[model samples]
Target: MTQPILVIKDMSIVFSSPDEADIEAVRQVDLTLTPGKTLALVGESGCGKSVTARAVLRLLDRNANIPRGSILFQPEGEAATDIARLKQDSLPLRAIRGNQISMIFQEPMSSLSPVHTIGDQIDEMMILHEGLRPKQARERTVALLDQVGIPGARQRADAYPFELSGGLRQRAMIAMALACTPQLLIADEPTTALDVTTQAQILDLLRQLQSDFGMAMLFITHDLGVVAEIADEVAVMYLGDVVEQGSVYDVFARPSHPYTQALMSSIPKMARKAERVRLSPIKGTVPAPKDRPVGCAFTSRCPYAFEPCATIRPERTEVGGGHHARCHLLTRQPVEAVA
Candidate 1:
């Protein structure tokens, strides 16, 4: 069996507050990513998907702390390093980030510098990580821009981020993320801001790049359509917990958790007029971290929630080949009996 490149076990993220109680944004979440495979982390907004991804890079805010968990990353022919324990500005971490692992932010405009040319920005990464001279780095930057389908890459590289359109800006961000040819890439809603055509193109570009580089990916998004297209494995999160997880084919084929089922039902299905049905919008909003339920975080919103769901926490139950769900309904007595 192939070994996993990254493993996150029982990770919980908490944010400190002065007057109020500390907020636990993520709770005991586990994820595994293998080399050259894509694992999609799907959930609604404020569901801790982004926070969990950021933890792998040790990029959380100062107020945020990992009270528990281990983020173990194994580089090729190297010993496993626990990223969770590394200091934010440690030399070892600085060497690993942007070299072995890179991240693409949700917004290109905000992530890219307005003062620097796109070429300079991308070149800096190569200079820092690969120790390449300015002249050589510029050559590689232009090639990277072109590789990401940017038109007039040589000239465009000299232009500031504001000079490019949304699609071009996003492409530049991708180029920068790929400059060092990282072993793993964390993409946090990389295509969320683009138009439909641009979104598809970006997705295709990411897939092509992943194939070319043979790198693992942690794809974070709320869109099921995008997940279906780019993901090999899928983990469905709700509130601060991973409710269901399995292969893309398995989870999409047979979603075991109620939250997962609700999310699937909310998708816009393309079918004949006779077969069409109204979209089922999931009721209730996600509770704040401080307001998280004692048992299942999604108990307030879960339609199939039972008596045990409100007070007694449920453990993960196997749902066949490598598939699992954290739900009381999976292991408890019949739903009708509980109801």
Candidate 2:
């Protein structure tokens, strides 16, 4: 098997309050992304999906602390580098951020500067990351816009972000992300604010770009439908921990974690018939980071939870090749019990 391009081992993030209380936003999360594959992080709000994504790029806020773990990036044909230990002033990451690992945010309107022309914005990245001359960068920027399926690339490149439609803005964002031929792309809810048609278009575009560049992708999303469309592997998170992870087909077909089952069942299906296919909403909201439960965070919502689940946290154990889940039920009882 090919070696992974990015490897995150036992990564954790904490936020220190003014009162000196620590809020753990992420706990012992491990993930790997190989070239030409995509891993989707799926969960509800406050499940630490976004925090995990931010940690990969070292984009966390001021109060956030990475107390332990390593984010190792092995650039193509290069030695492994620890991104977590790199200093802020160091130019080592400059080659990685836009040039090797690009990111597309949820809100393009907020991510893109309204004052700058689309072409100029993309050219800025090319200049900084690739050191292309101004004229050369502008030429490549227009081609990138066209490559992303933007209509009237020459004219549209001159328009400010505010002057473009939502779909166009998203395409522009994709153009910027692909400007430097990155080896990995982190997409944080890239289709959140768009309509259904536009969302489909953007996803299709991403898949095509992934194939064209053969770059690894870390796609963060809450929607299972979106996951079905893009992910090769799926990691289900709950309140800062990965509850279940496996190939997309196995996780969706036979979810071992109770939380994963609940999420899958909630998706509306047209073929299924019932008085009403009841959507199983997880009982309570995710616990606040400051007040995270000691044991399994999903114990309160898990139907199969027993005494052990409430006190002793479960270790991630392999149920099948590359399929793992964290739950006491997996340890104590037969896998049949949870299934």
Candidate 1 CA-lDDT value? 0.92
Cα lDDT tens digits, model 2, 190-307, are 9999999999999999999999999999999999999999999999999999999999999988899999999988888877675577777777777776666788999877888888
Q: Rate the local accuracy (lDDT) of all candidates.
A: 0.92, 0.89
Can you tell me which runs of candidate 2 are displaced by over 4 Å? 75-78, 273-275, 333-339
Scored by lDDT, the top model is: 1
Error of 2 at 309 (Å): 0.8
Pairs in clash, predicted candidate 1: none
Per-residue accuracy of model 1 over 54-156 as CA lDDT, tens digit each? 9999989999999899988983447789999998899879987888889997799766999999999999999988999999999999999999999999999
